[model samples]
Target: MEIRKSRMADLPEILKLYEEARAFMQETGNGTQWGTSYPPVEQVETDIREEKSYVCEEDGRLAGVFYFSEGPDPDYAEIYEGSWMGSGDYDVMHRVAAPGRVKGAGSFCIRWCAEHSRRDLRIDTHRNNLPMQHVLEKNGFTRCGIIYLANGEERLAFEFLPKDI
Candidate 1:
């Protein structure tokens, strides 16, 4: 699969991917994480406009999408119950979704992110998002601790640092 920055023309397909992902989450007992209208179109559009959104494509079809950014993300500033592994720069991955048509598309995207990152990588998931937790761990992310959103919604945080680092 190829990973590339999202463009305005890809908006429709990206929205559909998110919709299907929301349904999959609901069916898998993770409905509350994104609810019905989370990651609204405007946000996706903003991500595209800002060049932080990306898509995974295979043989001319989109298989996954995500938001990645360089961090000290403000929301991650304070961790509870544990702490970050390192004290330098890091990259964050968020809003990941895949339609499941291509096996390992999401995992591929995650591993790609880790391999390409110059700094450590960080991610978080809803407490109930077991599938995501599994994928993260499988991709070598370590459960770091807990972090709260602006509204106080708690999330299980994870981090990945290359062995050489």
Candidate 2:
């Protein structure tokens, strides 16, 4: 699969992927991560318009979407009772969605961000998202701790730093 910057025209497909992700989360008993209101369509649209979003394609079909931004995320700035790995500059990922095609799309996105940014990448997931936690761990993302989301819900945070850069 190839990763490319998302365009305004990709919003519908990206929204569809988000819906699928929400359904999958519910089916897997991890609905708290994205519920029905997370990553509002307006925000997705904004991300697309601002060129902060990306989509993964396989054979010309969209497979996944994610947001890649540099610096500490505003939502993640004040982690309630936990601390991050460090206070250095970092790249943060948000709103990761997969079309349920390949099992490792999330990992691929994380790896891409880490390699392209050439810096520590941080991500957060709902506490009950075991699948995501497993993927992060398998891909060398160490669990830093818990942090509150923009909506004020606590989530487990993880970070992956490249060994050489």
Best by TM-score: 1
Tens-digit per-residue lDDT, 21-113, candidate 2: 898899998977788977898999899988899999888888899999887688777665557775688888888887477767877887788
Evaluate residue 115 in candidate 1 and report its C-alpha lDDT on the 0 to 100 scale. Answer: 86
Clashes of each: 0, 0
Candidate 1: segments with Cα more than 4 A from true spot: none
Candidate 2 local lDDT, residue 97: 84
lDDT of each: 0.92, 0.83
Evaluate residue 4 in candidate 2 and report its C-alpha lDDT on the 0 to 100 scale. Answer: 98
- For model 2, the run of ten residues with the poorest summed lDDT: 78-87
Per-residue lDDT tens digits of candidate 1, residues 1-165?
A: 899999999999999999999999999999899999879999999999999999999998999999998997888999999999978899999999986979999899899889888899999999999899999999899999999999999999999997633
Per-model TM-score versus the true fold = 0.97, 0.92
Winning model by lDDT: 1
